[model samples]
Target: MSQSVLPQSIKELQHLLWTAADSDYPVYVYREGPQDGVIIDLSKLNEIIEIDPANLVATVEPGVKLGALAKKLAEQGLRFIPADTLFYQDKTVGELFYEGCSTISSLKYGCTKHFLMGSEVVLPSGEILKTGGKTVKNVTGYDFTRFFNAPYTDFGITAKYLLKLLPVPETRKSVSVSFKGIAELLAFIKDLKASHIVPAYLLWVDLGEQSVFRTDSSGQLVMMEFDGLSEEVSEQWKNTEIFIKKYKGAIYEVSDGCSEMASKWSCLYRTTDKYVLTEEIKMPFTAQGEFYKIFYEKAKASRVKASLFGQLAEGKLNIVFAENYPQDTFIENIIEAVEQAGGVSSGKYGRLTGKRPAGILAELEHRAKIALDPKMILNR
Candidate 1:
């Protein structure tokens, strides 16, 4: 027979774990979020008081919010880059990682593994394990820490964690460059990387398609970016200007007016009301280029009049041209191309981060539920 496990608080967690036996049947945990979830929170038990940043590494109580960590780290001249996706600063890191509620900015920093250095996790059988370390160069023996810390809840319940952070860059900038062809844009990115004109945020705009780039009816477009500092960005901007002229591209100074222009690049969830947004499909950089060109031609051939909004900075291309057409066929076309051209398609944005097979994904999800609530006693 299988016994369900449950989590109450830190104190209750330890008390129940003390007598619980091993079980094979999975225990599912429901989170506080809309989607069902749960995890062991030891801070509530009083086993520990405070987990603070000691040196290069940080120890957290699992219930801490990333925003709070960033704010505190900022006091010491450090920052974490993320999509600013979190709705509030009060949510716990445990909720963020387990439920997979990370923002797009996390892409730049390398997802959970980027900031997560080490974790003190509580396994399903109530045994404690330590993985990874505080410093990049300090890993020892088996590197199981990162494995347990992933958003994959199939692993175990993460209670305490250690994170590694780098000193903030002296300069940070965002820039936009407009080009007629994808090839030209790639070349520009390559050139910038070679010249070391480092831009914290590098984005490309398709002047031909993106309405934000198109200034007038004549198809003239501009790129908007954040230039870091006076001296370094000046040099970088100059080099960018030189490249634009050689490539015959246009440059525009984007200022506060950018707030309105930035709407296109906003969060995908915001479009739920007005847009029947297709699931996000991910492919290699080159395949996306092909899909973009092909999709443009297909829409015209089918007389399914539409438009393209390009988020060049990120490798995201959105098609929103459908007015009267059944979206199923239009979406099917893209999915077909994606599969044929070596890309998998999903409408869910977060699925990309959690890239496991459907069967495996379900298994892991079930595991997460069990890891948080061992008795299978959460709801039942």
Candidate 2:
């Protein structure tokens, strides 16, 4: 933990940055609390600066919660589709980009970085660094507005963000399906993909070994979400029902009216957070069958009780296990295996680094950081 400072206004924020630049200790931009080093709490920077409904864009402070901002945008019949799976009620826009939160809809909508139009950053040198522009397509220069995708800290404090928005979909629906076996489930997913129905999300869930579904069920739960025009959604729903029935699998549809999608997504997201250690494995969807085979075998051999969930569309597997399980060694082995199999894994709570950067690339990153934070006093 580090000392905390709350800046109520931009001037105060600038002064705090000046003090941090002069100090010997590193400073971290803090939202909820001090993540590391000294804390620069930006919670007071909560504000919805501007909303252009015509352009489907909004300028918001870093501290504004996604849920609150969504509601504000919804008032104008627009939505900020976040890159977070569960739509966490308390999660802020800053934390999403700063922490690089992964989302279920990433396969279709792309990641959080795509939604970021611009930002205002308070560099560690006590100077403001504004990047990007207010428009959607600004390819002016280096995308300094983009997140670094590290868990520790950014080069500076994120003050404000310009977010791209979308009109609230006219319809939204989710379908949950259970298969008789893993092979059967994979086959169904393969068929669904070939059918060309683009669901908002397709997630695979492990119901746990103790659950009733464990004994009587297929040991796999696949959830699919679809949102768009009413007619298209209805047609897809019907086709999906027929397709599932073709495999003799159980299917249930939960429309957006019940808010069931959010509830279920939240439940799965919470399971990952409840555990002490978790690692996300990313691979091609085609290799999921072989990858999961190796994954389960390793877990069984290690006697580790692991919960599994995946963003099926993007082929990202999220594995969560209790603290009692072998953490370091197991994760290292898993990462090695995943890489050997042409997959990628970022150990326990960080963005996946597909591969290690080369010497010059790594050096460039370091030089860029130093150029912005010469003292390394802002969240080293």
Candidate 2 lDDT, 1-380, residue by residue in tens = 66777789877887888886786666666422344566767778899999988776789887888778877888888877782335455678777776556766775677767787887777766678778776746636666677443333457777878888888788888777877666777787777788987787787776545221223444567787888899999998888887788877776556663246346556444434345326777888778778777877787787666656777667788776654334556677777888887888644343232233446845676677787777777655
Q: Deviation in angstroms for 204 in model 2?
A: 1.9
Model 2 poorest ten-residue lDDT run: 348-357
lDDT of 2: 0.69
Model 2: residue 49 alpha-carbon error in angstroms: 1.2
> What is the alpha-carbon RMSD of candidate 2 to the true structure?
3.6
TM-score of 1: 0.61
The numbered model that scores best in lDDT is 2
TM-score each candidate. Answer: 0.61, 0.87
Q: Which residues of candidate 2, in runs, are more than 4 Å off? A: 30-36, 83-86, 147-153, 208-218, 270-273, 324-326, 347-360
lDDT score, residue 375, model 1?
62
* Alpha-carbon lDDT of model 1: 0.51
Q: Name the lDDT value of residue 170 in candidate 2.
A: 88
Cα miss at 7, model 1 (Å)? 7.8
